[model samples]
Target: MASGNDMKMAEETYSGFIGLVKWGTILTAVVAVIVVLLIA
Candidate 1:
């Protein structure tokens, strides 16, 4: 079993990872749109 501190740390890491992924996806989409506009 994990300790309370370990669990808290894991949660914070997961949250940060999720936030990074979310922004990454949004950035990718925005860049894709910009590229398409430039091409068209």
Candidate 2:
């Protein structure tokens, strides 16, 4: 069984990973928009 501290650490890690992915997707979208504007 997982300890309480271990569960907390895992949750933090998962949340951090999600945040990184979310920001990465946002950045990719912004870049795409900029490129489209430049092309247009």
Q: Which ranges of candidate 2 are over 4 A from the true structure?
A: none
For 1-40, candidate 1 gives per-residue lDDT tens digits of 9999999999999999999999999999999999999999
Could you give me the TM-score of model 2 versus the true structure?
Answer: 0.83
Full-model lDDT for every candidate: 1.00, 1.00
Give candidate 2's whole-model lDDT. 1.00
Clashes of each: 0, 0
Prediction 1 TM-score vs. true: 0.94
| Candidate 1 local Cα displacement, residue 20, angstroms | 0.3
Candidate closest to the true structure, highest TM-score = 1
Model 1: lDDT to the true structure = 1.00
Candidate 2, residues 7-38, lDDT tens digits: the string is: 99999999999999999999999999999999
